[model samples]
Target: MTWTCTECEFAANEDGQDACVACGSERPEEEQETAAEAAENGDDSAPEVVVIELPAKEKLGVKLMPPKDGVIDHGLAIDNINNPLLENKVQAGDLIVAIGGQNVDGMGFSGAIDLIRKMPRPLAISFEIDEVRRQEVVREKFQQNKDNDLDTQLTTYAVVFDNGPMGLNLEEAVRYGIDGAVVRALKGQAKTSGMISIGDIVYKVNETDVLCMPYLEVMNVLRNATAPKTLQFVPKEKLADVQRVNSRHSESFRLRESTSHVKQKLMNNPRLVKDDGNEGDDTQSIAQLIMDNKASPNVTAEYLLELRVDDRRMVMACTSESDKK
Candidate 1:
């Protein structure tokens, strides 16, 4: 039997233990009574926290916003394309309850960051996985795609690819948002087969639905599956409808609530503009001049295409001399 510490919220401590192992905080009196009552009533649905160990050497590759006013809240890390948190099966809005067994209940934004920075290698971080966030994200994506014409429904198709040179570019088959494995380009035998085409999203491999699986896990499933593999795919445009139907079938996948003010506040962050240094500033500044019969400026569309020799050379150099091709 185990009980959660109220001070640190560490739930892994044994019942006999007088204090929390993580933060060394004593168990709360209310928690002790609740645990006793739960045991007496045979309550088996007690909460269990999930924790993950991450090495300090690797960057988390995530953008985190500090909780305002030292309020400990969930969903500090924002999810975006290629975010490591998403790769680890964590949704956009998950809690960072503790770092290295220390609870971050009142830790200010800077304090949390400092703790994470100073923590030892392979730090244990407890996360309270929130499925509501996942549902909201998927539902938002589904709503965006609702504008697609549903009158002409596109159905999924299957193609069997033999062993050797399957012709699918496995590298580009990585997960992109909720679109699953998008078919970027098809060549060789895959192109020869009229059944599959570019822009088709992989729905399943060997009749197993991998739409929600991690990209690497999906890849492993493909690599380990038996040959003469039947690949199921749907037109890229119809993925949303399929997801909607799936959500309808399973309540867990369905959207439970709309986006909240807290989530919106967290999402509203300043964007960073990248600066490509002015290497050819002088040459690009020299624009070709054109004048009408009156000698006034005549900036026509054709005239805008024209540039001085040096400017043209600079532009070509900027494009790695690809303009000649």
Candidate 2:
């Protein structure tokens, strides 16, 4: 009879041969077939292997310096320690060893002082000094272990200019009953200049009063207000010329001049008088008027003031005494 070993595919005559010539297996054909089937089905395969890779170890030279017994002054600047580290030719990965009480003599290393104060010790300390390199290492370690699809929430707010006009048109400005002013007093005129160059207040809009509102809020109201608005505000002192120029071209020129002059006269009066149940006749002091009326306190007042001073300085520096007008 012919016999074939299924395990090794070895064939031989079964005439007195109990084992296959190639495999040396004495198993019967049926057993050999079963073993071969188990191998094919992976039932007899080797177990899966797992490998973990650790970060490469680099030797950092660390020496424990004896703690200084005396208290260090706490006021010692970080520059003192940082400068020393730089001077000693300490590389990024070098370790700094510090010893002393909670405070370094009173002034130990800033980093060490912080750590010791937070932790209870006989503090024996060992740490790498590679600030930049250590941070990179830590970041890389966490990044590798992080999951791919993580959800994160982010919130943002608009950057608002504190004192600038936030882009308002005439219609919107009028609809919100927005009021603003320009003042001549802010311009430092000796008399009514009539040129309303800067510093004016808008005391009211469409006869509605506004004295306590912030400048930006007033602008926002105007920019968002409905069309065809009337803005009424007080002019600063020494700005009669500017007021005339502004009023001349204005649609309500006649009414504005008459009302403004009346308001001015009323303001000049020492005794306050109520007109038509309105307190103080809708008039404001020159300083209050300028603060309330200017487009931007930062730009119109602050920036202009600084620029004027700088210009005067530059002129004084360049001009001879006769040239100064």
Q: Considering every candidate listed, which one attains the maximal lDDT?
A: 1
Q: Count the backbone clashes (under 3 Å) in each candidate.
A: 0, 40
lDDT of 1 by residue, 199-256 (tens): 6777789968765554566778888889889988887667555555433333322222
lDDT of 2 at 58: 16
Tens digits of lDDT, candidate 2, 1-325 = 2345666764332323466444567758675565567656866232211111112231222222333443343222121123332434433333332322111333445455455445443333222234454356457546644421110111111111223332222211111122233332331221232333234445444434433354455656555544445544443442343333332233421234457767666567656532333467366554334434545322211111112454232111212333222
Could you say which candidate leads in TM-score? 1
What C-alpha lDDT does candidate 2 achieve relative to the native structure? 0.36
- Cα lDDT computed for each candidate against the true fold: 0.59, 0.36
Per-candidate TM-score against the hidden true structure:
0.33, 0.16
